[model samples]
Target chain A: MSDHLPSTARKPGLTSSAPSVVAAELDPPTPRKRKAPGPRHEDKRVAILRTAAQLFADNGYEATSLDKIADQLGMHKATLYHYVSNKESILYQCLVLSFGNLDAVMSEMEDRSVPPLQRLRQFAHSLALAQNNVFGRCLVLVGSRPLDMMPGGEIRQFQRRLDETVRALIVEGIADGSIKPCHPGLVSSMLFGSLNWVPRWYQEGGKLSIEQVVDSFMDVLTSGIAAPRR
Target chain B: MSDHLPSTARKPGLTSSAPSVVAAELDPPTPRKRKAPGPRHEDKRVAILRTAAQLFADNGYEATSLDKIADQLGMHKATLYHYVSNKESILYQCLVLSFGNLDAVMSEMEDRSVPPLQRLRQFAHSLALAQNNVFGRCLVLVGSRPLDMMPGGEIRQFQRRLDETVRALIVEGIADGSIKPCHPGLVSSMLFGSLNWVPRWYQEGGKLSIEQVVDSFMDVLTSGIAAPRR
Candidate 1:
């Protein structure tokens, strides 16, 4: 029972590892195999996370309470606590999920054997699509604020990784002559900022689709905003 | 007492011409004319606002209380409240101050006889400086959040004005054949996002000065990251 409970949602394993080992020894795992989380349980957990994320983005993280989230989801507070340890865990889950999607895009870029410029464009297109949704939008708008307040350095480390990945790509592009020579650091910040801002102004059910917006953004990024010299 | 309070800070006088007149008839003039706000009072008000802006930017607006701000300033909360109505007002003042500085730059650009491209460059330079400081940084970081939560629409109106100003500049640049033909709205969003992101990473005593960072950003915005054709 003690092994199952975490002190803080962020640092669940902070308590003695002895407790978990002792609990495992005492309980032999005979009937608990059937009690493990199933697909339905996982789906409910995801639903809670999705709802919490929208609430956090709509009302600020500090402004949002677990009670409000449960009420919004038409669930009891105890039921929400059953899935998530606390509000921070919900926030952490949302950010982790967002980072996972971005990492998947980065991995896709990495596996491709294309020119650096093409890789950059592909990354931009994928990022624009990712940011068009609520999860990605919250990651951008509320970015690092909620994480900065909570315990653990994982979120900040994730941010640094994202920065380094983009910066390295730009550097590679410049080295291969596929992209122009520019300060990679500044350019990465600019690129990420521009990409993240898409959901803020991108109108849903508007005339221009997400594809058009991403293309225009990529065009400005790649071809420059200045007209060609005569 | 009724005459002293305004309904909304942006449009304090919106409700009634009758209220002030009625209050004046009921009250006789007194020696309080000498207690009218002087330059010293105005300076104190500005100082309070400056401190509040820094606090709001560092810790979020909602998280920052008037009590904390007063404590930071070594004054009592009541004394601080005497200078401003509430935390929202402090945020509003910071935003208005930031907008005033940006507006001055825009006005200077308008007054100059330079070409539209030159004006755009100048505007970018001035914005970088303004944003590097506390007031402008708060305006960008806390941007429209507190204002949206408040009753007045002034901040949104201010945002629209800024959008119009930058969009018009881009339109002029394209017409003059200085800038490339692209969607002004998308380009403007990109440019502003990039500019607003400067304060996030710009170090005070780093190797590159503010001027260097601004120049590099402007260079990228103008020439872009793609290599020139032979």
Candidate 2:
């Protein structure tokens, strides 16, 4: 029963041989896959991406090679070309996955009837949760370089769409006097810079749970910590 | 005379070849040599880095190459290698120059009698300034990957040291009643995160100047845009 669950959420499996992107997908060895004679092709593809992400993250992207990725995955190097056309392809896929997932979560929150502040809190939690899977690791480890190679132009547009939504929320909050009248860009800069950069310092066993991490940031940002400047 | 002022900082007519670090000491244009070389070698190095930073920032790091860097510089492939060992070294040098200069500015502020908030302001300027210079472009282009082989240990330690200093100042501000008592880590996280990440979107000659960029961030951070609650 436990097999279906993603192994660990935020960051427990350092040496468990789970590549950052594919490890979570491996849970619960599903019932249908056992009949095939070949190794699970989907799983292998995920594994390749997982391996590629690690190599890309560990060694700078240009330094990582397909042979090395295949060697690490214990397969012929050419085998991976079937799943991904180039090393860069894996990076692009990982980013699309991360950004796509993030936008979906935030959009889902926007549909709720809650106040903008409540919505933000929900967002902070949802944002934290996305990192539990493979896509989150890729986002942090690789940074923001992949957006350039994208042919879809979807990634940037997606981000802009999301930013507009957040800005609208902020503007609403300001107009009604429900929250602070902060610059949308500044609030966003702080929120994202702190959240995006968290993966760098976050350890699985840090005193704070991911929830606490979100709360710590929200508390300061929403309600300035000084005793009301009186 | 003003045209020569920047040259006074380096050699007057030396070709601004992309100097490679392969033979670090032997290849370096010494202080005198660099001065005479003036706007040539350093300018080329700066130009190459400017082009690379935008490319690296636009595309992820792995997708960029020395050959690509040379192409952007309108130079031949072999010529690019003469400036650095490999793409990773370029990334490293880019970051090191940025970080190294930031360290100098922070220390200079440290010795001054400025208040803690003012000190923070100075630090912000120092960092933001680098984002526009030959050094900052290097740092911002490859800033997040500390464990990257090129700058590896030294780079990470330097970042940590700076982070700690920022944290300490935030704590001091809180304790002295100059600033509110927010989570020190989160404060530093938000402040440093936003400050360091500025290069991701800022462009010179854009609508906002560097000072304007710094002001935009500082304005929101120093004073909450939220109204004083009853």
Candidate 3:
């Protein structure tokens, strides 16, 4: 997660090692032998998602078609359907992967041993770094707007959980006396706004490294820009 | 700006009293005495833009069409073209107006009479308020992705200018000893990320008013979320 890979190498997947629900769902059941999807099958699904995410990020989701993704992947459109149902499904999977990554960050935030402010900093750092990846870029840039008519409220639920995680961290910080008394909801929005906006302007080979960017954000978040009074 | 009206009343336009460049450019060259566009023409043009902006914000720029905008405005598609050449033109005009609003904030920030920190707060306040409007929602939500094929680089220029304005404010704040030492470029990005993300989650009549939102943002931005040192 620390190393921001180039476009081709940026195969964003669920942070956990287990096969994702997307991977499981994409694989059709065979009556003869109901076997777990092999590593190769999982790899292909991830690759399809990666390519689609890059295309979606480069071209608007509405503009990027399944045919384009297949062309990018050097696969037939039929073969592309073998991996995902449609463009929206690919987008849904990308978001699933993205929210999974955030869930991992939330787990870190839940570590009571660490100070709440420190955990919040870690959350910001991890989130900004995550945005450097293609899937994260898709989540931020392409967004869930294209998935408006898609069935299932999983995305909305994930979004609500993400918001709650940030708000919870702020509430904990306030209770622990590490953070100032502030509206958790408003502060959470500010934190997300700053972190989520990273992908819009952050470049791979830009002058400032992702670490530097995250550090600057942390400084602004913790100490703020106001000069110390005499 | 303080009054964030409902969708119908949210007719976002150029902040300046003078007729916008978009309005002038939209008008065709007449062979007869070339008089300035009348108030009725400007009103109709603004109405078209406002209606189109709402559609673009609601349905997205890609999904929206001239026909849909026309249907929304109760005008024929050909009549819609009378005011704007194409959907891209309408999008470009919306962006033009949104940036024009930001340019107004930039002008306010340029007032050296106010403290740099105060000016920075004003920038955040004005910017968040601007996001409550339909055009601002178009800029932040739909974005300039669909207009990638559109010829003019005006949007890019406006974006660059917006970045510079924010950076200049941070630099000024630092120079005046009002702001702590920091990377102006990175800080500007953080500031913009926070403000721009407002349109995504801000509701018209949500629990928090735009004023409360802006105020909370200013608080987090000025005073670090961290509790005071012993």
Highest-DockQ candidate? 3
lDDT of 1 at A64: 88
Q: List the residue pairs that clash in candidate 1.
A: none
Worst 10 residues of 3 chain A by lDDT: A1-10
Q: So what's the TM-score on candidate 1?
A: 0.82
lDDT (10s digit) by residue, model 1, range A21-118: 22222223344365655556567777787788788777778778998999999999998887877876667666655553566566666653786667
- Per-candidate Cα lDDT values, in order, are 0.67, 0.59, 0.72
Q: What is candidate 2's lDDT per residue for B167-188, written digit by digit as tens?
A: 7777777766777656777777
Highest-TM-score candidate: 3
lDDT of 3 by residue, B50-120 (tens): 88888888888878888888888888988877667677667776766665456667777788999776777
What does candidate 3's lDDT look like per residue over A56-141, in tens digits? 88887877899899999899999888767777778877776665456678777788999776777788777776677877788888
Which of candidates 1 and 3 is the stronger one according to DockQ? 3
Q: Cα miss at B164, model 2 (Å)?
A: 2.0
lDDT, candidate 3, at B91? 77
Order of candidates by TM-score, top first? Answer: 3, 1, 2
- List where candidate 3 sits over 4 angstroms from the true fold: A1-35, A224-230, B1-15, B18-32, B225-230
lDDT of 1 by residue, B18-51 (tens): 2222222222345557454555656777788788
Worst 10 residues of 3 chain B by lDDT: B1-10
Colliding residue pairs in candidate 3? none
